[model samples]
Target: MPSPARAAAFAAAARTILAVTLAVLLAMAGGALAADAPAGKAGPEKAANASAAGSGDDEDEDDDEDEDEDEDDEDDYEGMPPGDGRDEVFAYCSACHSMKLVTQQGLTRADWAEVLVYMVEEHEMAEIEPEDEKLVLDYLARFYGRDRRARKMGR
Candidate 1:
């Protein structure tokens, strides 16, 4: 059993704690709602929604036009062999020969080694990536290596 004075003090403490808690909770909820609303360049929730709904469609249409322009620049590379940076290496190296011609020749690493050296010496093949000669030789060797002698196509 509490004395009258003690009971009144306890009741006052509980009310103060509850009031502070309610104030903190309301402040948090107000902050959450404001953040969830779009912060437009206009600065108010209703104006942000109106600006987006009314004016943003044109921006999206412009994006579609830009994507179409990029597609206009890409050309298809035909039948390159499997290798890392094969396309870049091919793009630079195979202007003299079709990718098909390079892939068709059956050669050991030593065979392509001589070809690369010959191109570098007789016809300038430009300085390739130091590692690329080996990679290209390996690709050429594996696919075309099985048949060393050439055969003409179509009887």
Candidate 2:
């Protein structure tokens, strides 16, 4: 029912509307892509923090591994005989503290037990079985007993 000029005008209006819609859609898409695009440059502080975090994680892993190795050394006597459970005590003791604690103390079995108890009670040392403690004490008493005569002579 439209006249010729009116039909042409309506067609041109519809075409103009479509062009505007297309332009808006393109602008939105361009904005979205720009938002997602990588930042071409990072600030120095951000870059330094990221680098330090990564390096810290690696160092923590290495430190944890070393602690694990120390614990293992304190527990295992892979080559020692069962009768020689003193080795286990030595292993456990030498893991965190030093063997000097044992060697330097001119201690009897009772003295060693007291020291072990002190370590467990005060310093939060590992819990050792009573029998294991006895065995280690006996071994130390037998092997590294004090030279009484030398002490008496004082020479």
Candidate 3:
């Protein structure tokens, strides 16, 4: 039987070995996941821009057709109702996330204001200019407000 001090030392060494093994396993798993991930997947902003700019390919004729298609797609706002501040809302919100995420919400004006504030404060979103903020709020309230259900039902 080992002395208590030797036993404690063995236990400590075993813990160290276990920790190192876990760390190595975690690292290998992470690397494997990264390797398996699709090459076409990208961050939100990059994906949006890539979709807009078309696939970067060597075919020159296809590139010209893509450019024309991109021009037409520029005005497409992904189902956000057309309104006075549609451009501002699209430019700001779509920079970080899909416009579908924005259009699906049916919050009141105050709730929308709170969400914008939360996004800026917690998510490090760029602060909207005061004039643009007002326009965005108004546009959201008009088209996507809580009353949207009633309006849609009536329509």
Candidate 4:
């Protein structure tokens, strides 16, 4: 058998070789990932430049399209009526989810309260203050509760 010192030296050399190989592999993987990344967003700048170089026709059309898009963006919260709790609900809920999803639900006040609890416990929504929670619950119960849903169904 080899001497203990020689065996320890061989083991240390093997470990060093393995560590260097792993480092090189990780570096190569990082380079490949960087190389495969999507190209930067120079698309709109190019389009604008091209439009500038051309006649005014494309620029006018683009302006009209942008105006239409702006209007649609403004209507994103159209379903939620203006009310006391509207701002709170919008600020809290819409941070993560679309307001449309909130407007579609129709639950009783108690159910709405439970939903808030669920949001906190299950989905880790921020805890609303007790006073704010009451306001939000009242608003939901008034506008999106079962009675509103029933009325919509002509009940």
Candidate 3, residues 29-139, lDDT tens digits: the string is: 999979744222332344356556865665556677766755544436665654567667777787688787998888899999999999999998889999889989999
Residue-by-residue lDDT tens digits, candidate 1, 1-155: 99999999999999999999999999999999786432221222343354358554454467777566334312223444344444444544555655566766667668877877888788887766677666566666655564543434422
Q: Tell me which residue pairs clash in candidate 1.
A: 106-144
The residue ranges of model 1 lying beyond 4 angstroms of the native Cα positions read 1-75, 147-155
Candidate 3 local accuracy as lDDT?
A: 0.76
Error of 3 at 148 (Å): 0.8
Candidate 1 CA-lDDT value? 0.58
Q: Which of the two candidates, 2 or 4, achieves a greater TM-score against the reference?
A: 4
| Index of the highest-TM-score prediction | 4
Clashing pairs in 2: none
TM-score for each model: 0.40, 0.40, 0.50, 0.51
How far is 34's C-alpha from truth in model 4 (Å)?
A: 28
Candidate 4 residue spans exceeding 4 A from truth: 1-76
Q: Point out where model 3 deviates above 4 Å.
A: 1-75, 150-155
Cα RMSD for predicted model 4? 12.0
Question: Evaluated with lDDT, which candidate comes out highest?
Answer: 3
